[model samples]
Target: MINRRTFTALMAGTLAASGKSFAETARGKTVFYASVGTELFLYDVDAEAAALTRRSSVMLPAGVQYAWPHPSKRFFYVASSNGQPGGGAVNQGDKHYASAFRVDPATGALTPHGQTLALTARPIHISIDGGGGFAMIAYNDPSNLTVYRINADGTLGALVQQRAKPDIGIYSHQIRTTPSNKTAILVCRGNNPADGKGEDPGSLKVFGFNEGQLTNLASYAPGNGYGFGPRHLDFHPTLPFVYVSLERQNKLYTYGLQLDGTLSRDPLFMKDSLGEPNNRRAGQGAGTIHVHPNGRFVYQANRNSAVVDFQGKKVFAGGENNMAVWSIDQKTGEPTLIQTADGHANQLRTFGIDPSGRMLVAASISPILMREGNNVANLSAGLTVYRIGGDGKLSFVRKYDVDTSKGTQFWSGMVSLG
Candidate 1:
């Protein structure tokens, strides 16, 4: 196994051989990280030119589900598990953990920083407080959340003992801390309408945060949480607005953030995320959402990569697999659909925009068999890069394919170097 000192030395040698010092090359550049199976890759991204180059890769003990960087940009946390995403449910397993890594400020290289902590259930999402004081992990199978303190050296401490159990609703997908560092929000995506099974209402669970303890604050749901399957949410950089992506309803909603760190009772505006909203298909639903760095635009993904039998062979079902671009009004916090860019591949599970807001990269999770004009071909897993214009519209630049046959490209994000 490669230790922290060895990895740092190897990165320094690599930079020296290329005649580029780490301090000179990595200051303002953004690095894109993707977790494919057990391996994590670092890609050097060019915002002005809209291109990406894979730099290095490191393997984890298990398959990665989610990752979040520290507020200081000096550390990163990853949740891994032996289980995988089944056809319609999560494949259960015993191995689950949260690992801390030290991120090199000048080189973007990641090295193991502390002891890996064992988790009772597979964590679906992980995030840190804005003050970098605590690490929060959310599990969906049992619907639980855990908190770990951050040591002075940036390593993770033991789990904080909880005095009260907050009501973490069913199927929690994402967790985030508010800008004030006084509140935490969990997006609970309820079960979709299925055969002979009634719909399970979804909700946004909010809690008050003080130091490392949590107190249940409020629960916000439209129409008593029915028909409100929220998968992910992103807050505006300078406004009191929260944008959410409804996974089951294929819609986007905007909510007003109150002064006391609680969300409003109802949504301020709701809009369809699909291009052909009236023509609903079988596998059409929303995926991830992100707000632009400038706060002038918001982006969400619509994925429908279901392969079905066609002409006695399995092929694409021909539904929408694209990214929706919405221009945000600064005054009223309303979002309007400007364009829907084709994702070139299938099932874009996650994506990230650079801090400069000049480039966007979308990750297509798995490969699928699709019909290309009359011939059927296997579309490999890949990452698509786009150039963001001045008006917040995205233009396709290029795509780099990956071999995800071993495991899926589960999560991807971009972090700025310190």
Candidate 2:
């Protein structure tokens, strides 16, 4: 068995030998961004201290849904829309856009790079291929995917029309390209049965990709995807393993990443994500899953924002709202639950880990009121920071409360400074 020090050294050496340009640029500084409504704010991160200092800000055309950085670390892509949840007459809104930004390597500031591409619907997630040649966007309402070329100058190019109508399952949440850049996976989180509606099965849509064009390859939906609702997935850094966060079931699934970019038909292992595995409640779900840079650990967010009417006011319905930490077995790629650290807020919609894997910052979407004995206390939306230990555990460091009156703290993530 490899020791912690030896494993870390090996991972570092492998990264150096790979000579990834982003790693070279990220050697010294780390920056973070958080979006509230149409404005995106930047922060400087001190990983050792587990603190964040607000820096600059930029505005998007609408509320920011998600963002991804180019492999070169010189550009960033953002998706924005005026749409709100609950599809039908509940305000679908009209405007949707995908914008590109040029990253200032030295200061980690952003400026508009290319013309914004108008999207047909609100983009739920956006990702760039490993080669940084194309940007893939996923829409939820109609469940669709779009590919746009990334210009040499790091600008958004025209959409690449696909001749194959791949089956994009219900409520697509995320789209990502495989490490080989030869295939892509779309995470479709089918809706759970509600209001006399039947359960819409979820699926992982795999496609063969070439020159920004995608062809249908495979769709993996165990048990016809009745109770499976995967929100996000992350690949192991050095192992042929993929970890998926099941949003609806509050579970973590491990799958083998095949040579051809398809996943194993059945999960290799599955584990409960919640600390109280038996106490499942409405609105209790998993948000994101990410593997540590050293490949020794995986982290996921468990969120619960369910509310109940009490004394003519909405009050927090207690449930799990924290980060679930898992220790990965290096040899077999199995994960064991180790810790469930408190998030200290409601609706942890997103979070980011520093490139060095020394710190993690989670963002809560909005404030919530919880009944404490006879009185109610307000839990404000904020950015919670934690210090990562050598054993892949997290220690609570500090939290910076954010003002979300203007809009929810919708999205936040870390980006290595180039």
Candidate 3:
């Protein structure tokens, strides 16, 4: 029995089968990705598999650290984290720019659209609005967000609005929007544990976005006690629920949206039960969190178990290098641990819930490409397709490899297919 969603998805897929016009194929399409030491590779998703087919990559200009494909998919942007190692994060005095490139569908090569756009802080994050007319970005240094209007040709306009320091401590970790597309949330947290209190505390700030402008709607200073940082969030597809993934403390916080648009914190503060003395180590880093399409399950990736913060601080909460699963209560909009050790490090960085909510497409990151031999194996680069069992357990159905060995470390990042 084909449902409307699946039926609609098939017709949409057939029409945009060719990777010709990015605008036509970017929506509702899946793209495979692997992160090299400093580069990103993109592949068109295979019709019936998680494997990548049309391989393409774009170079991050010198000084840039990392970037992601814009939600719009018309352009790919990369942020220049630093000119040199430990360059003190691109402060305002510096350019702190974003590399804008035209995503070539034929070859997958990124063509420079123009000079880098000046950003308020280091470009750790960028996102497009629901209307697809504007972009908002979060900077790591000075901690700010800037708005840029999107041109019809996919180029970014001038920085229309620049928001600074909604929170007192830590840098801006991530900037994203609500499903309604009426508001945006900016989560603050420090990457390195370098603050007066030995821990950089952060806050979650919400803003009302209208006509390409941002207005301070409200904010919640969960206090430094919420643990190191709150970086990413996953919104339930059917419920007004959201899950926040913290980095410093390496914990998960759940929230329920109120009728007036305020987010209320959940009573249950869920933390991984992996390591007793948990610490922040890239090997055991809390990569990402997402709810299954059906809204009944939530999952997260753990990178390592050592000190995750560069300041030599232990993550202390989540330490194991595996995948963790939880059952989401629809009524209360909370999460309860269901499974752990689902996959390897960097595996959760990029994965997608199956359209039916019964499965997921997962990938792992390979850290060996840094000339860091396979012994330590920080990132386990591979692909896994898992279907959920009746008990909410994750079961592997099929797995894929980095088809081409040349691209050693194809660390997964974002997974989406139209």
Q: Give the whole-model CA lDDT for all candidates, comma-separated.
A: 0.86, 0.88, 0.59
Q: How good is model 1 by TM-score?
A: 0.92
Candidate 3 per-residue lDDT, tens place, 164-269, comes to: 3333335775787776566788878765444544655667778777777777777766644446577778776655667887765667778765434447743245
RMSD of 3: 8.1
The sequence of per-residue lDDT tens digits that candidate 2 reaches over residues 161-233 is: 8988867999999999876678899999999888999999998999998999899999988889989999999
lDDT tens digits, residue span 71-169, model 1:
778999899998766313457677898889999887789999989888888889999988798999988776788899999888989899989988899
Task: Between candidates 1 and 3, name the one with more favorable lDDT.
Answer: 1
How would the candidate models be sorted by lDDT, starting from the highest?
2, 1, 3
TM-score of 2: 0.94
Q: Is candidate 1 or candidate 3 better by TM-score?
A: 1
In model 2, the runs with Cα more than 4 Å from the true position are: 1-26
- Each candidate's clash count: 0, 0, 26
Residue 145 alpha-carbon offset, candidate 1, angstroms: 1.2
Best by TM-score: 2
| Candidate 3, residue 23: how far the Cα is off, in Å | 21
TM-score of model number 3: 0.72
Judging by lDDT, tell me the better candidate of 2 and 3: 2
How high is each candidate's TM-score? 0.92, 0.94, 0.72
